[model samples]
Target: MPEAPEADLAGFVRAHDPDRFLCTLFAPAAARPALFALTAFNHELARAREAASNPIAAQIRLQWWRDAVEEAAAGRPARRHEVATPLATAIGAGLLDPAALLAMIEAREAETEEDGLETEQDFVAWLRGTSGGWSAAAGRALGADPEAAEVLRALGAAYGLAGVLRSVPAHAARGRCLLPRDRLAATGLSAESVVATPHAPTVGALAAEMAAEGLEALRGARRDIPRGAVAAALPAVLAARDLMRLAAGREVPAPRGIGDRLAVTLAGLRGRV
Candidate 1:
């Protein structure tokens, strides 16, 4: 095996983010190395997009990140990017699933660029494409067949949607609103109001709606995947699901709002897997 990258992808996966670590536990051991690298690349990319000193520069950097992901999908890794190194390693494994990865990058790019979600459809597409994409990639790494992969993708999306809903307040603080602007308007809630007061009842109601939709989607997905993998991943999903429920009830904090639920998710994944 190649020597581990300086970032040490596996250690990052193990040491940070309980929800992601919990979700990764069900992945086939054969896929862990590549999966860890892919995830590490994404984590670094997300942080960089948010932390760049200049906002314009941050957008440009995020664009470059998208280009790199596109290159990975094309089987030609972008050579100079730091995150690209480990990302390319994962791509080389032939287990990283380019379609899902590319979709995720594209969705992230859109989220970085948008002022606010103009429509419910746009918001749904972003969630299904990004988080759903991550779930699909995870499923592809662990599942034995295409059908299994599809089911896993849906479950991943369901779980991811819950996370997104729980982070509504944080997204608002950053001047980005993931909830549909049109839907908020329908409820007489302005995006400005949400930004001003991230804890509005309308925001809580919208988050609850999104979480409910995710649960329905997950139920549909669960019927198709293998029982063993489904059993393994369900605990994490349920934990996230519960957090969504709590956020809907106006019980959690901001983006880190799901911290307690994440602990439950980790316990559930370890116990079940």
Candidate 2:
């Protein structure tokens, strides 16, 4: 039976990140709690800026999580919070690395401070630092070999790019444009234009370019991902699905359904994602 705290953590992930929540179901039962906690911790950090009233408040909130990680690393008690407590448990179980978690938080902090991507390299680096770091940590938690780091990084980059592309409308609505400035400039579209006219021809072209890049990354990683580590890279499947939808000009955020779960399960069984 799942512990109360673990159940709460599972519930949190289910509500905030349904894809990851479903992915956890395929992981080893013993590792499910740790995965849930780790993903929920990600949700907390990713939303810090949006949840805060101001930049300073957001930094403070992120700092709290940083402190909690440090405390756990030092063998001290972590902060008493829903995510932190279970994260501490995962840390204690040797399923999570303190430095990796800290890197994720730092990446999110940088994102909160930056306005938009300046170059393709900048965007890639951001994705590697945030989503790559998260996927790598999940790989470690799933018992992936250290040498699999590169594969996990590639998968994370692909998955991260796809997610950002799918969220264009929502991000634009909030005055945030994730497209590289150079790409936007080449297409004669500004960050404002992306949010203001998301479906414009130029914006659509830029989205397609990004989707192509993401698909290439996904293909590159698929060739190298070990069968034993595929579960950790399950998000790559959803990333592919989303990228395909974007390429087809279909709606990106489809509701989670039995079909989605079965697709993920089949992908997992084949070690394809």
Model 1 quality (TM-score): 0.77
Q: Which parts of model 2 have CA positions greater than 4 angstroms off? A: 1-4, 222-226
C-alpha lDDT of residue 231 in model 2: 68
- For all predicted structures, in order, the TM-scores are 0.77, 0.92
Please state the error at residue 214 of candidate 1 in Å.
3.1
Best by TM-score: 2
> Runs in model 1 with CA error above 4 Å?
1-7, 52-59, 70-82, 227-236, 247-273
* Residues forming the 10-long window of minimal summed lDDT in candidate 2: 220-229
CA RMSD per model (angstroms): 4.3, 2.5
Cα lDDT, all candidates:
0.62, 0.80
| lDDT, residue 131, candidate 1 | 59
Q: What lDDT score is found at residue 109 in candidate 1?
A: 65
